[model samples]
Target chain A: MADLATFDVQSMNRVDLVTVSGRIDSSNAGQFDEILKGIVGKGRNNIVLEMNGVSYMSSAGLRALVSTLRTCKRNRGDLRLAAPSERVVDVLKLAGLNSMFSSYPDSVAAVGSF
Target chain B: MSQVEAVFPARFAEIARICALVQLEAAAAGFDEKEQFRLQLACDEACTNIIEHAYGGENRGNIRVLIRQRDGSFLIQLHDTGRPFDPSNFELESSRQPSADLAELQEGGWGLHFMHSIMDEVRFDFDMDQGNTLTMIKVHP
Candidate 1:
């Protein structure tokens, strides 16, 4: 069975660039949270999420993102979003979380923000 | 008017399938891409609430959904038989407010908030004989 979401992570000197593609809903949100936690657990706190391929995100997905963001910020680092789809941006706005994380238009900008 | 009904097992894995079904109906009802996306998110959160709160656990019960397109509005009624739950009891003030302080944030109630924000009308009704029903309506824009 093919997975509903996939995450590919590349570690940089100051940030971890994670390219994510697929739908993030209740079913796979736990998996998403675990993967992010794993990334932070390995002594990498700064994260740049490339979300060009994310087609959908529900409140459950937002929960995972919030949890990860809190963890990153606690370690004096941050989680930045790059190239989110329009739908994802709308969701973040509706959830009143658009101001929580700084968003960039592309991965280069997001990575450079760190 | 067009209508579609389906029963799904109350499991986390079934949320995407449910959303897909709603997406089809929403698109058929003349919802634009943005409205369809809102419907999908509302549907996803509603089903998740059923599985997690109404059923108390996954696979313990079933979620029956009815989608209807009528009179320039999209209507969704979700029925669950596991338990009677008043979702307002779990409402969090933080869900409606965006705060940068992590300590004051609450992650649980955003699902209900999303459902209410996306749908124009949201109502919950419970009957001893008919089970719990959550009816949500979105007016065509």
Candidate 2:
């Protein structure tokens, strides 16, 4: 069974730190999009997505991430990624979207990038 | 050949159920973690394309995914009653790696790349009498 999806969201001075745990597949990608949308909707554009706890990411997840990235960028804000698991990195790389987001080794570095 | 098949309404929400079913098959086939992830991702990408493209914007349709183990390989076929997509157009560029600058990156298009990259074999077929079928094959490691 897939782990229940959860997002640990924090509001920081510069960015919204979203610590995503469990699998992000087609199953719950809609909810994931909504969370990101809600964050951006609240006028917080710069988002630091922590992916260390993300075990699986499907194309649906990528769509949510890219859509969120586009939304943030349109507002002159950016979305950075932090500590993606090997599988997450592989999916991002395979999709050629790895370079689209600023990625760091840790959350501190990622939050700093913003 | 051992096989199982299911049909789902073409809704974004159904993607989770489809993927979960795929994972079960992969696990029962004794696929390693990496292999299971690959299968799940590849199949998920194909289904997403159908939901987003063939049946875009609250359109109602049906998607059927079939998984079969034959010989030393796994075969996955996705059948959908949405728009007819020429799967050939989705072919991943043989030489394209994922290192391009983000500014140079495009938003969509990556799902097909990921599908082709992860699966050992991917093909598409369309028939007016039937529907669209996307075939993805992965060899047992």
Question: lDDT: which candidate is best?
Answer: 1
Residue B118 of model 1 has an lDDT of 90
Q: Which sections of candidate 2 miss by over 4 Å? A: A26-31, A37-45, A67-78, A99-109, A112-114, B57-59, B92-99
Give residue B110's lDDT in candidate 2 (0 to 100): 67
Candidate 2 C-alpha lDDT tens digits along A1-114: 567679989999989999998888766888999999999999999999999999888877887888898889989999889998888887877776776778899999999887
Model 1 per-residue lDDT tens digits across residues A10-86: 99999999998888888888988888999999989999999999988888889988898888888998999999988
Top model by TM-score, which number?
A: 1
Segments of candidate 1 deviating more than 4 angstroms: A1-3, B87-95
Deviation from native of the Cα of residue A111 in model 1, angstroms: 1.3
Question: Could you give candidate 2's per-residue lDDT for residues B16-89 as a string of tens digits?
Answer: 67888988899888898777888888887788788888777434788988999989899899998777886556
Worst 10 residues of 2 chain B by lDDT: B92-101
Give the per-prediction TM-score of chain B.
Answer: 0.92, 0.91
For model 1, residues B16-133, the per-residue Cα lDDT tens digits are 8888889899988888889888998998898898888788889998899999999998999999996887656745532476666775777767888888889998888888888899
- Backbone-clash count (model 1): 0
